[model samples]
Target: MKSLMQDVPLTLDVVLRRCLETGVGVEVVSATPAGTVRTTWGEIGRRATALTGVLDGLGVPAGGRVATFAWNTHRHVELFLGVPCAGRVVHGVNVRLTDDEILYQLRNAGDEVLFVDASLTDRLAELADRLPVRAVVVLDDGAPVNPVFADAPRYDALVEAVRETELVPRAKPDDAAWICYTSGTTGMPKGVVSSHLACVVHSLSSMTVDSHAVSREDVLLTVTPLFHVNAWGLAYTSALANAKLVLPGRDASGAHLAELIEAEHVTVGAAVPTVWVDLVGQPHRMDSMRRVLCGGAPATRSLLDAIARRGWAFHKGWGMTEMLPSGTMQVQPPDLDLDSPAGAITRVGKPSAGVRVRLVGPDGQVLPWDGRTTGELETSGPWVIRAYLDPDDDSNDTRFHDGWLRTGDLAVIHPDATVEIVDRVKDVIKSGGEWISSLALEQALAAHPGVAEVAVVAIPDDKWGERPAAAVVAADGLAPCAEELVKFLAERVPRWWLPERIVQVDALPLTTIGKPDKKALRARLSSPSRS
Candidate 1:
């Protein structure tokens, strides 16, 4: 006989309902073009419920894709929950992407209703006649003059016209509730669709002590863009834990973030390493932060040391758009000495709960977790995606293998279950028939004390085939000469692995999401503009 148990569906609806019931006092603060606005979870729930009215009034079909091209504001937060709960899909367009990328995503996702911030309305205007969207709703109240979108309506008017109804989720747990596209550094962007069940499971897994450890009293500031992996799942984890959330809007500047952390007493936060590097240079207090989750790229020892000196905990995390974005959160062992060469705090930690990882060598065999053997990291779990949205895309074969995602990341797995990402498979430099880690070289260069930022790329060389070339951004008024940098690395790495060229740049080129744009850098080096 089969065992009898209630099969309650797991979905974002449950997460939202739980927050509304128990998190009445929790606050959702945001800085927008209209200035700062504060609202309670209860009020947000009411507004989110009201938003459904607008969706229904506009005749948004069930499971339709509703897109947002706005910042991390209170209104955008509404779409995060409202659209999905109303039986529609939420597609957050990365505002930082190129216009071509933006247009492609807008058309590819088949967005029906486009919601944009007043300040960002001009973006829609650029593609006004060409866009596939049926309607455009501006996210402001007309305080800042709105750009005419032909026949698009204002957000304030739409919300005011819709009457608040009893809140209820319309979609099933396994239905696709949100969509996000890859960075497409290698080619055109691929879309990833996440189910309601996956997001709910990720939220619970993220609350574990090894992850963000979200809790009722924790005040978390999101420096990560909401368009990026749902801001690394904090939007849901915060609600599930009843934690206060502070959104920095379009201004994630170091100065603004520092002020927000101090003013809001933010206890935990997440951002890329570049943002933290800027924060260290800013003259602002960060005593309120207890832990910060750093991702997007590897964290340098110099950056981590600066954070450690402030009595704050620094963590390195890793993820991808296809993994529902929760891969690993590094938690150092109690007995491990961080000062040792092997104790570098840069490891991306072990896989989060409910996730499994394996390493496969080029020979198609599973590698040992001895921390020495490196291979491509493959992952599979409840939240990890099995395939891309397009089946016809040729990347499917190389990206997914036997229900596992080929992460394209070269990494070593330690016996302690920790993971150290060596480099992207395409980014590993080969010289004299030996492989060199550009990431490791950049890490060593960042420790030079005078280097503010650095990116290591493989430049073509007739003698070595490809050699490591470092682009250095010197700190203000503390320029370390290229010769001094080479000498500094000579002590740390093999002499043959040294970068053949040290190109000094005022700033390193960055991708839309803030990571170093290595593709662009390589193109620049290959061009005839080097003087």
Candidate 2:
């Protein structure tokens, strides 16, 4: 029973060719310290081709890993397309990480060459003696080159020196194209490899109507860091959809982003909840914006209300490093009640096409979508990673079980197929044999008028085994009252779920990726001085 069909491989080459052919008028704009720089898709395609030639001249073997430590700019976009299309794996090192963490990733991944921005030379110089890379290249961004990188060749000079080579994708569909490490708040970061087939499929899925719905007419402002999960795949989606791509260089402040959106007429944007919170009060013309995608952390009701007041469509997305950066999307249903606590807009939405999700109990039984029961979430799909890059690692045993990636998220799936993430398995509070959701408590506290930010962590208690403790940041110039916060939560959550201790802080500790550092907060709360 053989069916007749073409065996064309799905790869980034296909995506690149389509982008250049149909995106004749499309442009990629990058904000620079000097001013805004713009280039057409045709020029980017040409530059990407030259970049492949540069790699060849540098003697980087096929399938070797190339590490990039730079901001989200046009040059970064070149590596994003050039490295993968030419069969080399592009590893975008998180620039926000500490020197030790950065060194660990470079050594763990066995990166051969390091491409860095001129402004970040000081950070690179600190680890220059210990770097495993064989060569270093600098991308000039109006910053003086550090003495350590003075001997390194400039990025533009290298690309311009190499003769333009024929543009052909050397890697197969199943070959590795990109590597992204998890944030690793609790432990060491693990590498996640994305295949060309997986990337192409995910990009297509992202452009579908129910997902991001990117199109040729849309101008996408990518506020997320390019080093994290491929900027949630927005860069690739923009190319495939022939949409205009805008990159806000090193500065992501509210004022800068507002100016870019209005000046570039950005129609769609994606970033974390923290970025959106910073943008709520920025006075700018954003009437052209059609949709805003938020992830990395849950959005509070206050933040959502603020966006609603601006008359902008807001969507909450759920994903992980294992799932190619996206799995579920929040799409409003026709019958959904906007004010209901369990509405579609409040949930993380249904599983995307080609992805399947289910909940599993502690005893290994699959849970039902009764809109009340909660358990660990598990997902399986073509794009999901079967295992981490290091096969010898012990964490792989618990991360993958029975062909499903254990998401480590405690969640409830409604009968309508929407998902409500309660808390992380390690972050949940265990009091008197009952489970309490830290995320639920934080969401309730964030709605308070005086509370600007909140984080809940489990504190050890002899009586209850583990009880909830909170750290809060006050809004504006007003100081928050602990008694008032307790009263506010008393009406929303169970009486037992209330935190045993609440401490006011200037700001919540954050991870490198901007999520609340619960592990650090737990350590701070458990300190003898705090006690």
Candidate 3:
């Protein structure tokens, strides 16, 4: 009964070689500190081969960790190929982490070779002595003089001096390929290790019609940082599809991204909803864009309509670091009437193939997908992490049950498998023994013409256990009153969900990754000046 089929190993080298073979002429453009640089996939492949030789010369052991603290530039892309293809784990450290967090990740990962950006030399030099790194490779045109890393080598010297030859050894599919840490919003950051097979499957699964819909003809302008969740897995998908990549290094501002999208003729762009908010009202020509992939937070109805007016579709995705960053994507059925005002704010769509999703109640019972019973969302898939890196770390115990990851996201699943995220488990407002969704309230407020940004948090109330309060940031050229906003919400949502107080502020506090820092807002509301 055995059917014979040729067995092939799924590793990073498979895609790296495929890119060179099929996409040798595709352009990889990047805006670097020096200036705009352009290179072909063939040239990058050759350079990456040379870099692999350099890493070998540096005595990088097989399965050793090589860390990169850089932006999404062409050089970083090379590290994406060189390190993993050379059988070394690519540990991408988030550059925006706090000084102490940066130190902790570098030391905890036990990274051997530190490949840092030139701009971060001073920061790395401060903690280079404490890390287990044996060599420092500055990823720049020339090595800068620093007493702490004076002996470090420059990226250009090492690559150019080495011979152009493939040094990749045969690797197993289960070999560790990359490591990226969580945002550490609550506790110390935890590492998520992705194997070669996991990433290969994720990359292939992501480009399907229901997911990102990537192809060779698509030009992707990735606004997400490479250090965070594999830049939403754009790196691997682009290579797999032989698509053109445009990297906007360091400067992800509205104006800069607008210019790059136009200049590069970017057809598809991916970033969080906050970035889209910044670009929506700004003067930018986004006519070339066909679709925008938004994640990290849900997109408001206003934002979606604004993008639709420009003839571009807006998509919402829901995921975390543990799921290889892609769990669900927004896809409306043809029968659904999305043109209606009520249907404008779309839900996070069904899970992709090979992923199983369910909602569980507080009593450990599975909730039905009836679109009414709200519960904690849990997911399990080939790409999802079954456990954290540390064997004895029980701090995240409540985060997992059996083998599924407890997403800590409060959501309702429809009969069609589509999910509408109501709130985070910690951010949901509990008032009078009824649950109030802060995200739902925020979405309603954001639809107001004058309300530009809004974040709702639960504040202490004597009558109810807690009441919802809003931190409003007005839109440009318009100032809205609290009474008008309250009336606006009264028409849309239940009167009980309306905020008792609305505090106008210049801007909402944002996390390092540009998410609304609700934790800080809660602390501020507890203070006397705000209370």
Best by lDDT: 2
Residues 14-33 of candidate 3 have per-residue lDDT tens digits of: 77886778879898998887
Give per-residue CA lDDT, model 1, range 1-531, as digits (tens): 986988778978887686678768889899876678998776666667677788888888898899998888778877887788889999999998777888899888889998888888776576777778888887882345345663577776777787665777687988998999988888999999999999999989989998878888799888888898888888889888888999998888889988898899999888998899887767877777788788888777677777766667766679988887889987543344557745674578889999999999997789999989999999999888887887888888888777789999999999989888898999999987899998899989988888878999888888889888889988778899889999999999999999987889988888878889999888876556642
- Pick by TM-score: which candidate is best? 2
Which residue runs does candidate 3 get wrong by more than 4 Å?
Answer: 141-150, 332-346
Better of 1 and 2 by TM-score: 2
Tell me, what's the RMSD of every candidate?
Answer: 1.9, 1.8, 2.3
Better of 2 and 3 by lDDT: 2
Relative to the unseen true structure, what is the C-alpha lDDT of residue 239 in candidate 2, on a scale of 0 to 100? 91
Clashes per prediction? 1, 0, 0
Q: Which residue pairs show backbone clashes in model 1? A: 330-349
- Cα error, residue 61 of model 1, in Å, equals 0.7
Model 2 ranges off by over 4 Å: 1-3, 332-338, 342-346
